[model samples]
Target chain A: DAGVTQSPTHLIKTRGQHVTLRCSPISGHKSVSWYQQVLGQGPQFIFQYYEKEERGRGNFPDRFSARQFPNYSSELNVNALLLGDSALYLCASSFYRGEGQPQHFGDGTRLSIL
Target chain B: AQSVTQPDIHITVSEGASLELRCNYSYGATPYLFWYVQSPGQGLQLLLKYFSGDTLVQGIKGFEAEFKRSQSSFNLRKPSVHWSDAAEYFCAVEDSGTYKYIFGTGTRLKVLA
Candidate 1:
């Protein structure tokens, strides 16, 4: 089966603009999570959605939001983009059987803010 | 909050030499630990994970990690280094009660020919 997929592979936006990033979970996966990775650092959790319901959220500001679709696909939306928001946005999908299932990641979308 | 720490920011080793990368985590409950590797411009790939059972867990690409609860460390090791192993390595811990995954800053491995 194909791995988790993300799109726009790359994006560029201006300050105060809003951007939406999309993710398609692996087939049969029920949970999707989003993470933000800055240069020279590991990924930080952003949000997690299971069965189209928000399950968890990270410490990001209210400007950041996400939603999962009925098919388990997810979209991460960031409002009021800042230069600091320029980073690699990663999407991961998991089976979410009970708990602690491993997450499979996508290559990630590189978001740049000007 | 829970967190992961990789004391080494970068490591350089000669090909064919043994390798080791250190990781430490702070959490309240029994931790679920994992090791992931990322090539440049690529996403992370799981190397291995530790939830229960044997403390020493073997993973893909001839890598293994030993989880020591007393020390709160899950250290990754390889018997012989390969140039292909040059990349960034991250240590992550799953939140026992949630889907949160806390990751370390990452240790970049530089393999010398």
Candidate 2:
């Protein structure tokens, strides 16, 4: 079974520009979460979606937003990108949004803000 | 507030030597703990987790972690290290009643020949 898949393995954008990173969860998975990993730092949770509903959100600013489609795929959108936004965006999928399931992650999209 | 801390930023150990990484968490309730490994330029992989029951949990790649609630720590250990064990290890904690998780800064393990 293929694990979570993310598109645009790498992306580059200028300040004030907007960008969208995509993710497709593993088959039969119902939960998807997004995280931002800055250089030399651990990933910070951005958003989590379960069953097409916004289940949880992190401390990220309003500029960061995400949504899950009916098919369980997810998209993370960022507006007015800043140089600090340059980081690896990771997508993780799990069977459910609970304590028992371990999230499976994608290779992630390396986003660079110029 | 929930938080996770990995005291060591980097560690180097000779191949075939024992290895241990430290993790500490701050939470009010019973915390769900997890260890994840990330290779260079790759996503994080689950090494193991502790939800309940046995405080000592075994994971893939011959890794194990002992959770100490009294000390609020979950430390990962391996009997012998290999070149393949070189990676960044992150310790995460999820609140028992919430879906959120807090990850530590991570410990970069370097295997020496």
Candidate 3:
């Protein structure tokens, strides 16, 4: 089966602009999570959606939001983009949401802010 | 606050040499631990994970990690290093019952032929 997939392999936006990143989970997966990986750093959890409901959220500001579709696909929206937002946005999926559930990650969308 | 730490930001070793990457976590209790490897411009691949039972866990690509509760460490080890092993390694920990991961800054490995 194909791995998790993400759209817009790359994106560029100016400060204060809004950006929407999309992710398609693997077939039969029911949970999706988003993470941000800045340069020289590991990924930080952003949000997780299970069964189209928000299950968990990271410490990001309100400008960062996400939703899951009925098909288990997910979209991460970041508003008021700042230079600090320039990083690779990764989307992960799992069979379910709970303990011992390992996530499968996508190549990620590289977002650059001007 | 709970966090993960990788003391070595970068490591270099000759091919065929043994390798060991350190990871430490601070949590109230023993949390689920994981090791992930990321190639340049790529997403992370799960190397291994530890939840319970035997403290030692084996994973893909000849990787293994031993969870030591006393030291709060889950260290990744490989008997021999290969050129293809050069990449960034991240240590992640999640609180019990919570699937969210707290990742370390990552340790970059450099392998010499």
Q: Of the candidates shown, which would achieve the greatest DockQ relative to the real structure?
A: 3
- Per-model TM-score (chain A alone): 0.97, 0.98, 0.98
Question: Candidate 3: where are CA atoms >4 Å away?
Answer: none
Interface RMSD score of candidate 3: 1.0
Query: Which residue pairs collide, candidate 2?
Result: none
So what's the TM-score on candidate 3?
0.97
RMSD of each: 0.9, 0.9, 1.0
Q: Which sections of candidate 1 miss by over 4 Å?
A: none
Docking class of 3: high
- Put the candidates in DockQ order, highest first: 3, 1, 2
Error of 3 at A59 (Å): 1.1
Candidate 1 chain B, run of 10 with poorest lDDT:
B93-102
lDDT of 1 at B93: 96
lDDT string, candidate 3, B35-80, tens digits: 9999998999999999899999999999999999899999999999
lDDT of 2 by residue, A1-114 (tens): 999999999999999999999999999999999999998999998999999999898889999999999999999999999999999999999999888678889999999988
DockQ-superior candidate, 1 or 3? 3
> Which 10 consecutive positions of candidate 3 chain A have the poorest summed lDDT?
A96-105
